[model samples]
Target: MRGIRNMVLEILETAFIQRALVTGIAVAVICSAVGFFLVLRRHSLFGDALSHMAFGGIAVGLFTNIYPLWTAIVVSVLAALGMTKLRQSTKVPPDATVAVLLSSGLALGIVLVSISGGFSVDLFSFLFGSILLVSPDEVYIIIGLSAGIMAILLLLYRKFMYIAFDEEQAKVSGLQVSKLNYLFIVLASITVIASIRLVGILLISSLIVIPNITAMLFGKGFRKTAIISGAIAVSSVIAGILISYAANIATGGTIVLVLVMIFLAALVAKKAERTKRLAGIKAEA
Candidate 1:
């Protein structure tokens, strides 16, 4: 306890830690918000696909000497929009499309990496996340994007929730389902890219989906679930960042592991509640 407290104090005194904490929490909140809808809509793989696609985007940016993060944002958003169009306009299954995009993105990244003369430490940091290395400018970018995403989402909350629960019904009910779908993919893409600095390309989806799932174990409605999921995701990121600092582990992976552990705990608690309820019912009978 004393050591943890000391570490916390130490982190509070460091600008890097402060930046990482803020950036991580922002990313968590944004991802959690979009993630809840993504999970409900069964588009969980969308984040994973976009993350890999962003890898290719990053590689291209680095090879061309442009700002990699911005490049990634553009490329990912385009890919996401393209995927949505393909899904709406083609007979290819959504999973198949995602799989194709995922492979192509990874292959393109590898080729770009080779063309760029192999991977560098910075590239590795982007791939696996390096929150502690985030610059002040990057922090500003992250926070700005997070706020914008959250705002747009809040404004369209009803339409998004309606679509998430039932797209066919939403379409029938006069909601612009296609437009909303495109909007959602764009939002998801932005969230995934924004999160790359904190949790990296590989683990961003876990950050998106796990908290929502964990919250769903107990939350009875969409609003409650989203609130709980956001809280869980933020808590996990904050805890993971602090523990990683103290334990000298990789922050991205540590945050993911922490989320998994919380999910497991939630699973156990849910099972216990179900059993107790069942026992009560039997006793009453």
Candidate 2:
């Protein structure tokens, strides 16, 4: 117990670890909030697609010798907006559009990396995440971006919920569904950019998705589900960081593993509850 407590205190005292905790918690909250709506709209894969698109952006920044985060944000937001426009203006299925963008973005990233000779350490960090290495400036960026995204979400909560539940109905009821979709996709793209430093491009979607679905297993209302999902994400990130620090493992993968474990636990609990309910029904019969 003393050793464990000492370790915890040591981790808390480390500046880099403190920065990582703040950044991770911020990323977790925004991801959960955005992911809840994405799941509701059956657009869970959209986060994955955006992450790939952001990868291309990161590559572009590296190739151009510019800051990758800015490039990533620009590229992701544009790609998301463009994709939304295409979906709105065409008969192409939404998933097909996402697939095309996903493939194109990844291909662009790969080609750029190849042209640049190979993956540099900087690129690799973004690809696999390096939350523990996050600097003070990056932490500020994460917090600022997260706050902006959350504010937008709060302001548009009702409209977003309406469209997520029923886009056609929202449109019919005088809501500008297309515009709202464009805005929502923009938010999601930004969220993906914000998350890359914590979970990396490859595993970002998992951070966005797994917690929300796990929360959903409880069959709660949207607000409660969002809150529970955020709680799960934050806890997993904190635990993952600490465990990875102690175990000397990859932090991004550790966080994702933690999320998966929680999800599996929730699934088991839900199943057991159902089984018990069924048993009670049979007894009554």
lDDT top scorer = 2
Best candidate (score: TM-score): 2
Over all chains combined, what TM-score does candidate 2 have?
A: 0.98
| Candidate 1 residue-wise lDDT, 1-285, digit = tens | 998788689787999999999999999999999998989888888789999999999998998999998899898899889988999999999899899779888998999999778998879999999999999999999999999999999999999989988889999999999988998899998898899999899998899999999999996788889999999999999999988988899999999999999999999999999999999999999
Q: Which residue pairs show collisions in model 2?
A: none
Error of 2 at 116 (Å): 1.1
**lDDT at 238, model 2:** 98
Error of 2 at 88 (Å): 0.7
Give the 10-residue window scoring lowest on summed lDDT in candidate 2.
Answer: 176-185
Give per-candidate clash totals. Answer: 0, 0
